[model samples]
Target: MSLSSKVRTLKELPLYLPRRFSAAQRQRNRRNAARPPAQGIVVGLLAQVCGRLVKAGEEALRIPERLPPSAQRVQEELKSRGYPHRVVETEETTRSAEEAARAVGCGVGQIVKSLVFRGRDSGRPILILASGANRVDVAKIGKLAGEPVEKPDAKFVREHTGFAIGGVPPVGHPERLQTYIDEDLMRYGEVWAAGGTPNHVFRLAPNELADMTGGKVAVTK
Candidate 1:
């Protein structure tokens, strides 16, 4: 795809990436483009370069020809909820925050790292949509949740969310949990979340994410 079209495929990403962050990347690309042949990087292609945000998500990301069962279910849920961005897959699994961010070509902070913790006493699931850049402090989460919370295992995650860890989207759980969003994630205009598989992800506005999950904004430790 041409560069602009490649960017377009990411939908709202180009417009919603942090302005200061995008500007800095463009400046660097301009400087790199002016370097002489001795620099060994091709000036023509380099000149067209934007930020990693421009090239990364579309280049590294893939649109699966066929969706798996879990992926298909997540797709249906997103459609049912009117989420504009659809799932994009990757050649490699985005099992970690770093991997997802790099694959999506956005800041690590823009990735919604979905986490599941069970109430220590209630035996209920609690979902935390934290920024990839911040670690959710379990103790603080417990305080915010008004109950002590502890991490759930893979089995619990699948049973509760209807998907495996690393691939759980912010919504589509069989049961609605008490959900919370990281204030840090709310700082951004757009954010990416898991698409029901380690290799899948999708983007959405933070507020819309909150609504979809019926989540409250919080510091998320």
Candidate 2:
């Protein structure tokens, strides 16, 4: 099975099992659990990547407890990186850049959307970070890639990134996928992105994020 398939199977197994936990089961789970909650490994890994790239320390801000759906994990990862973050609790869901901007009171251009596409070569996934105000120019992307760039469906996105489409982060694929960052994001000194989970988010400079992800800087949209 593909890596995406395996992760899907693992994520789905819980649905077939009971929700209640026995003492032994809980104990076993605790023994294997990692700190700061392992449910958001992708978010955690994003922070690790940021740490490696920034070297001088980066800011990772967490959202409030009652904040949107995908910024929670982002908050944790940001805190881990020593970034000063404010948690703004709101009713808006951060599923899109517009919504995230509204919830955080930022400009639409400042919302960084992590996008995933099926690479033209090897058929593996590639990640793109684009400004909220723009749409991806696929032909341009194809030329840069030297291969055709195709949009993957919802199932394909979840399978490859281990996160739903609306909550895709720049880092933390089951495998390291090729990443491209939009040049437009450079306009803002700081921008926000999903934290791996729907209820979390984090902010960073675009150049800093590019460095952290080792992402190619391009006009993605």
Candidate 3:
């Protein structure tokens, strides 16, 4: 099937993945992706939220077949959401903000990192969309959520969000984790987010993206 025709829901990821992934890791990720989606309302209900707002014209980021699981997952999620995307694969994983920006030829500030944190009291997760140039002040973010927010461990991220660290998208979590968008991201005309995977990213307009995710935009130091 063509890339466009093959993808359905966020669950249909195998159709887009490459045939040769590291045997051990590939098997593990496939299992995780196939599991039933955990019960939780997709926070925002805007139509074509990802595609309509994040991708535009010739600037769309392509999803490569050999991308890391996180990047691959992001591509499929965006595609499922109706966004046109292309995955840019790299020889090595772009696990950090600097590497992701370098791979896409953008400034560190333009990279939009999809971060997950656990609220101390509510036990609900918080997804923070912050600019690469900025750091998420845990105290400030925690205050916004009306609780102390702590970053969940890798196991917690996967268990709660379904997707692992590098691949978590801004939306599509098991629960509608309280979300925040840094005002700094809006300063750029375009921002890049993990395609659901670390190796891939999709460009988005900050304002429209905030609308799509239903995240309150705030200042983060």
Top candidate, metric TM-score: 1
The candidate with the higher TM-score, 1 or 3, is: 1
* Candidate 1 ranges with C-alpha deviation above 4 Å: 1-58
Across residues 1-221, which tens digit of lDDT does each residue of candidate 1 receive? 54346456756544322222444653443344322111110000000111433344344556666788777887899988776677766666777654544454444544556777888999898887765556667788889888988777778877987887667777778999788777876666556667778877666677888888888898876
Worst 10 residues of 1 by lDDT: 39-48
lDDT of each residue in 99-204, candidate 2, tens digit only: 5544543445445667666766668777777665566777777777778877777787878766776666665555677787778667655555566655454545
TM-score of each: 0.74, 0.60, 0.63
Where is model 3 more than 4 Å wrong at Cα?
1-80, 86-92
Worst 10 residues of 2 by lDDT: 49-58
Q: Model 3, 61-121: lDDT tens per residue?
A: 3334476665566567667878664544333345655455434433444456667777788
How many clashes in each candidate? 0, 16, 14
Candidate lDDT values, in order: 0.62, 0.52, 0.54
Ranking by lDDT: 1, 3, 2
